[model samples]
Target: MTDTHPELDDLVLPFSVEPLEARGRITRLGPLVDRILERHAYPPQVARLVGEMVVLAVLLGTSLKFEGRFQLQTRTDGAVDMLVVDFEAPDRVRAYARFDAERLGELAADASPAALLGRGHLALTIDQGSDMSRYQGIVALEGQSIEDAAHQYFLQSEQIPTRIRIAVGETLAGARHTWRAGGVMVQFLPSSPERQRQADLPPGDAPEGATAHVVDEDDAWVEARSLVETVEDHELLDPTLTSETLLYRLFHERGVRVFEAQTVIERCRCSRERIVGMLRQFSPEERRSMVGDDGRIGITCEFCSTHYQVEPAEVGVED
Candidate 1:
């Protein structure tokens, strides 16, 4: 919270407001974001949207209590067909997007999220590893932006009151231009035992222990939501503002507490070994069908652009 590592560019700070009984996460991405976007060389509009997804993924991933990987994916039928953000436990993140370059270039500079990705759903998946089954939750993409969609997912799937604000853009430093992103998320903690029981139950189902249950529209929740609304895009994207300082300015009256910051970096898990393992799944004849005129099987990782080449003998193909 104090910016202990000034050299670090991307990081997430987890915090809470004890008096309000709420927890939240704050994230900022600077050089790391630039590296990710530059690798893909996406159009301006697509880059901004992808940056928002990356920030949101880090915020939500860091808040989880899992040991494996967390992924946020969007599938649509607009100019951009797919956006994927992957967060590996402790501190690694990478993202990529697939879009029609010519169509994206034709769109206005200030295109809305819905206009860029039309008629689809946002899905959040958590992989706890081979021993455990994965969990996934999905919601319709019915918001003005990615933040709004995430808010709807929590309310609909988890029955939680959530607030999210995200900002992504390019900033000029000296002669170089780079991408930066920042976001803050807050969720209310239920006060009543009945409400807590209801949270665990599926939507529309009655809680076993709760005889009477009502939606929470308390003054505290309203006040907290109001305070979050005051946050502006500049404040979130400002490089000068530290996470602790920002939290103090936002909720000093209600009392805010900060936790240790987790460092985030650009990392890709693609390798020749993993690619070879995937190729082994196909039979010898099937593998031969994928060979190019160059007499080698080639694969390129979309996230990092790493290329892998395999020989005919590698997949048990006879000469």
Candidate 2:
């Protein structure tokens, strides 16, 4: 029996996710990458991986039900390094994945996560709401790809079967430094034999009811795994090719439903007021030293690289 619930459609670029099937959705994750790329000029490898994290943050954060933060963190001491992407209310996101900034352009697609990150662990942190305790799940890295790492997280933490395909690459360059990052994720919902009423499940190359079979008394899991396993590296990484078109082309006959989309925007969330507040923490002498001859202070936001100049006198210092 298929899920008869209202379905979502395939979402477009810049933070959108639409339902492509009753139980699945195809997301075109770009514009979000382009925004991040505008702030950076990393190598092909690093840029792609960073995009993957940004997309993953969206897919993993949709159900952040309460008014708090849902954080995805990966800590490592490897060459490529630690990566963290977090999503807050109203679908706001902030991401940073540190690497060999100096040696970035030298990396290749075949580079292993181990070679990039050295050693690491992936974690998901969620702040449900006020007073409620925060929830976090820790999962070990399994492959050189972020998709593989996330798959492991779903199994270990959420105990659900999931398939994740990610593509990271640049579509434009130089004065046109526009790049795109996109991904698709599908998960199986819990089902019971008593509820088995065929809702016309798609005719996937995977075995019939393979998802249910893999866990229970079904044998179709073998077929389903085979279908998902066929997703190719080239297909996932292609920019001109959108996710909806690809998924529809592959499974249209099986009744894949694509739905409405959303947009992902970029925000630094840094303000002069915030920076000024930080400066106040300094002692009188420290503040005086910072003021210099012109009595102006310079502070730069780490994420967006925006610089701010403030006058000491305007702030009104109190001894």
Candidate 3:
């Protein structure tokens, strides 16, 4: 399929290669990522990690068919210890990172994700709002990129044959350079149960001579996985390359078909009214304690850095 639309950014395009019984989505983020990172003013490596998180969140979040939220968070012992990226269903995303500046400064400039994140847990949560139950899956982060952690999530939780490739970098336009990110995720979804069979994980406790259960991978999935693995980092991050063209390059032989693309924007769900409501939940004394020397309570949103000030009296406190 050819994309006639002009080069666009921050959109998720879903596609399928029927011949291989595979389905997947590709996301390209330019201004959306730049806006998120600039708001935080993160260092080079920290910004790159946040950018990668945004790309991964979009790849998984766009898969939701309902109005919900998909959040990717990490708590680790590495220099860049914590990352939080939120994708509200349909098209809004926001992200932030917390790190120890001194620790990060001690690492090599080209530190790997494993090196930056150290050892911790990565969590993916799906929130369906107040009426439904929230679902969360967590996997250990033992020296792996966000891509590797995602693969682990699916392997341990979903049991699906999945492949994910993500890229993040700076692209120069005129004299200014800006952050850009892109990712592609492909999964094998065969119709027949036999074709979907996978080897069972080894038993933790068993006879010493017992062999582990093993099953051969489906050939169609193997072909699809190989093609996806062949994708290079540049292809995903190139500003001039439309996602359609990239997908074509990867699976043109297998005949890929694309669905209508979903657009994503950098937006935070914070507002003065929401902040005020949260303040009201606090006791009058607690709300009063938040007042600054100016005699007004102050709050700043972590995601967007928007500041809100409220008079103590407004929340049932006598100023």
Candidate 4:
């Protein structure tokens, strides 16, 4: 059941279960998650949350039809204030987190997402291109985990019945520690125009003594959700289980079919040229305010922590 392709460390598989009338996405991030996390020396709890965000971003971003970028961001009042992850089209992703070191240290290792993020809104942004309008969806962070928040997002925003299961942790390989994350998302798709029309129709419109058409689809949805709920975290994070094998194990009885998988890698879009272009837009006063005692302007990318320094002369400014 393993795919013939070699690099399965960071890949996503799009799948469908015909009998269940559902479509889903599965993602595994091994080396990619490790590479992204190694750039920053975050605490274990913080790192775990960040890893979950990375996996969640891939699962949600791959579901979109946009051509540019998909970003998942959270701003809260808890120990961890902000978590941001960006997924660019094809297969590139980068993530970063901001937290109060002292506060984070005080929390237990098994703190829930709600305990870590507190009161905040989870926002998803889709940037199609410079020419196309951007789209965003915001939802309250009411769940104990990122998966719960995401499920709520789909339920409220797209009116889609979705189930998400994610697991992130580190595994010891010999003497070295590696980060790994895997997630599965299943969404019930409307099967026909009649179903869609029934869903859109007011409840009162149902014929006398006739059951609502959606009740039938609701039963299917409930069954699919029940199956998804049976997925264990270990099954998702097990390195030995191929994506196909895992899907088969879960939905073999339901006739699951998978499409070609997409490979993902850790990538940051930050560059000196882009940074310089951005700085050039600032007025002379604004630019001067950014210069440090070293007589140069330095900017660091929050995602990759790559530092960029620009001399005043480079932007036609005299110190």
**Cα lDDT tens digits for candidate 4, 1-319:** 6323336769999999877778999998888998888789888788889999999999877767756899999999999999999999868899999999889888888888888999988999999998999999998885467888887777667877789989988877659988889999998886764442224445576677885545445666777788888989888777777889888988888789999988888999999999988999999889888889999999999999999999987876785
**Residue-by-residue lDDT tens digits, candidate 2, 1-319:** 3321112212432211122212444455546567675676666666666778877887667644556778888887665667777777546777766787655446556776556665578888998778888888887764456777787777666655567776666544446656655566665443553322223334468776575322241233333334446766556555556666676555555545655555445666679998988888888788777775665888877666789998886566542
lDDT of 3 by residue, 1-319 (tens): 4333334788899999999999999998988999999888999999999999999999999999899999999999999889999999989999999999999999999999899999999999999999999999999999988999999999888999999999999977669888889999999999887898888876689799998888899999999999999989898888778999999999998899999999999999999989989999988778878888998989999999999888887787884
TM-score (all chains, Cα) for each model: 0.90, 0.72, 0.96, 0.90
Tell me the TM-score of model 3.
0.96
Q: Relative to the unseen true structure, what is the C-alpha lDDT of residue 54 in candidate 4, on a scale of 0 to 100? A: 95
TM-score of model 2 relative to the true fold?
Answer: 0.72
Best by TM-score, which number?
3
Give me the runs in candidate 3 sitting further than 4 Å from their true place. Answer: 1-7
Q: Clashing pairs in model 4?
A: none
Cα-based lDDT at residue 157, candidate 3: 89
Q: What's the lDDT for candidate 4? A: 0.85
Single out the weakest 10-residue window by summed lDDT for candidate 2.
13-22
Candidate 3 positional error at 144, Å? 0.9
- By lDDT, the candidates rank as 3, 4, 1, 2
